[model samples]
Target: MSAIPVTIGRRAALSLDSTPVPAGSPLVDTHGRVHRDLRISLTDRCSLRCTYCMPEQGNEWLAKTSILTLDEIELIARVAAADGITTFRLTGGEPLLRTDIVEIVRRLAAIEGPDGRPVEIAMTTNGIRLPEVLPGLAAAGLGRLNISIDTLRRDRFHELTRRDRLEDVLEGIAAAAASGLRPLKLNAVAMRDVNDDELVDLVEFAIAHDAQMRFIEQMPLDAGHTWDRSRMVTQDEILGALAQRWELTPVPGRGGAPAARWTLDGGPHTVGVIASVTAPFCGDCDRLRLTADGQLRNCLFSTTEYDLLPILRGTSGEWEQDIDGMLRACVRGKLPGHAINDPSFLQPARGMNAIGG
Candidate 1:
């Protein structure tokens, strides 16, 4: 919890200004991609500076006052649930960095989706703090987890994440399995000449722990804006390497799912690959993003952002309807895909952490 390097910016735009709106029909975009998943950033501060995620120093941080409050977070979830967003994932620079995350989970877990089912709440964490917060999170109804762990070697772990917390992360993963966090998974970003050599080892670790593993293609979300396609480890190469050691087969019915899963032959273990760069899945993407500062991103690589704070904080009788209209307009504006392969592509203004991981 010690302070790290950060530059403060205007935060009145980031407050937990509530954005609750009147319940509307299921949110479907112009491309007919219905909004069913919502990724909400709880905070823009993290405990580590992963080389691929953020710079080692001089990164800007949102003032705590500008971060959304627990109430504000819950209200957004409730409104999204009404729009049929049943699967909600709480991400962040590190979601655990938020002091009231447990309460936030408790409130979000209570929301009912349009289908009459309670919203399914999950979290993506760095795992260092899971040992301390896992129990509270589980009790508060967290359905599952995706832990970010890129390396198995302690030295490499520190080198990659800029923190000596690999052991803590491993412990957190173990504790999560023990605590009954079903469908627990590990997220690893596959970068050429970096951690690709350890892909098999990472998958083995997941199999041994009775958890799923997913390797994500490196995208242009780094704070330094240095990502290039040549440096990316594609799904074909990843599968080729893993196939040499294990028998893997694709699992069917992976529509719109970010991860294309495969089962280890004769075993109950599975692994996934999110090839955002080489094998884009934008057509089936059923998700939206809400930054910790209250910016709504229609796509992970969206060039446009809708500021929902003013409408959220507005005091007007028709504000709810107006909020509903805004939601529809934003959804309607969703991009068909993130053109990473296109030479004309440009990265978003915010990094992955600022965009909620």
Candidate 2:
């Protein structure tokens, strides 16, 4: 509420001036993968320079000219809505960093749903700037939020994230709970020796606030290619640790949730673990991600991407139809699962931030 956070950008780029994809182009692609859920990155700039994603003060941010405008995002959402996507989420280097984020929420929320209701809207934030946007966003059609808070320790938090906002995020979590953001989930990327010890502490932290916590397996999503299996906190170790610390039991939840559901001994809140590495859920993968720059990534683990901006800007708008055709082409290689741990595997060139992580 003090003031909006500064969105990272040198200046407005020409990339935001592109035309929208036309209608009747069949937004649906081959594998029957209708545009069910769309993850839109507001910007590819994050405040936290995590060891996995960004090196300490050593990274290149995307130029302002290369990012999409709110209008561009609205147009894309509308077209994707026409195709079939009913759910939408705002992501970013940190979506909250984008000062115009609240307006973006309102714009995307205005997108008409299949049943004529506003689209189901949500955001994935780092919680640093959530306090500022929480009120405006909730009023704009945001249904829920997923905040990334990897560690509970203030010192370790600074060490891992290279940011100075542990208490700030904690306050945001409290504010989020009071704001009626039901099913608020804390996303924790489990890393051995970094924050793995906080797994139980995180669950306890969430329970006290009546919030759910999800421990996600660290995958190869960073830029430096520093992902190591030895450093990974596997699903087995997570469950084993929980079993030792608490009387854990399985709890039922959504089908497509990346987390393997579980509950504490006798707590009011639920804690989940997203076994992306030890247990990949590509079989039920029913989502798609569209980058802010107009590239379509069919699978997060796949390096292949289809550039859609060129097609969208062509004179006849024939690119509209090509968007559909391109999607169909992507299905041919939707990759049932990711081989991130394989020694022969190579991570996608783009960092997690670039890919709407």
Candidate 3:
């Protein structure tokens, strides 16, 4: 495959050596936020087609040659780890779709973080194939898991995902629990009149399975760009639904984490809400995403992307330096916020599935 032109701008001219980024050097943006979490998309292919993520068909996937190889991914990750990135979340259209998922996990788990420890590795997957990959992933040093199941009802799941694989997802969840992947999180996109009614049931199911449930406010990241704010189930609405069944007390100390957690009734098992729209957490954002095709995205909603594929595939003697510079440049260029609520906010061309939810 021919090399794609690098899209890095003049701002990336700042050299890593000149900056002298030491271990744990806060990859600070202009907003005074330190970025340490790196979310990597293993592939742009998935097993299910959720209406909010993508259409049922006619989805264009990244080419095999265009996707980053396991080696290339490790190289970038190693650089990120050395530069203070301590947490890595492997996401995808469905990460399990990658044939080298286990090897990918093992490679990442082997990388040493800024503190000289093996960097923490986690994955967010639609639980359809979790049952088959759980043992391999666990053994590969996976630290945590977040499984997406929007609805507990089989029929409802089919309606939302355009697939009748709720049974597979449930089995996968059970398998993950059995494998002792503790602090397991179940993610549900709370859509008004869709799965909003199942909020309480989902949390109860999570508690029974020794997992925490997180309900996410639907953002305008759908493939069709058909997200209507009026139709979205807000954080307050989700809280209201939960309050009807149980008393929720706020859990303190939610730092850069996306979810604002609340313990149910009193103590122990808790529920969370990722209010990306109603209550944006951009001020505390600490994530940077690397697309499956090797594009670096500082903000999930950012209109800008810096291409890393060219440098990765180039025979240019300064691969490491170039990548490090590009990475820093990307972070340095991060916007103060996604600006999703503002009138000037424009939805990105790519949807959630393409962007690696």
Predicted model with the maximum lDDT: 3
Q: After superposition, which runs of candidate 3 have C-alpha atoms over 4 Å from their true positions?
A: 1-24
Weakest lDDT window of 10 consecutive positions for candidate 3: 1-10
Q: Model 1: runs farther than 4 Å from truth?
A: 1-22
Q: After superposition on all CA atoms, what RMSD does each candidate show versus the true structure?
A: 6.9, 7.2, 3.9
lDDT tens digits, residue span 49-151, model 3: 9999999989988889999998888888877886779999999989999999999999999988656788999999988888778899999999999999999
C-alpha displacement of 355 in model 2, angstroms?
1.1
**lDDT (0 to 1) per candidate:** 0.83, 0.74, 0.87
Scored by lDDT, model 1 comes in at 0.83
Q: Which residue pairs overlap in candidate 2's backbone?
A: 13-65
- The C-alpha local distance difference test score for the whole of candidate 2 amounts to 0.74
lDDT for model 3:
0.87
Task: List the pairs of residues colliding in candidate 3.
Answer: none
Q: Give the range of the ten consecutive residues with the poorest summed lDDT in model 1.
A: 6-15
Q: Using TM-score as the measure, which candidate wins?
A: 3
Pairwise lDDT winner, candidates 2 and 3: 3
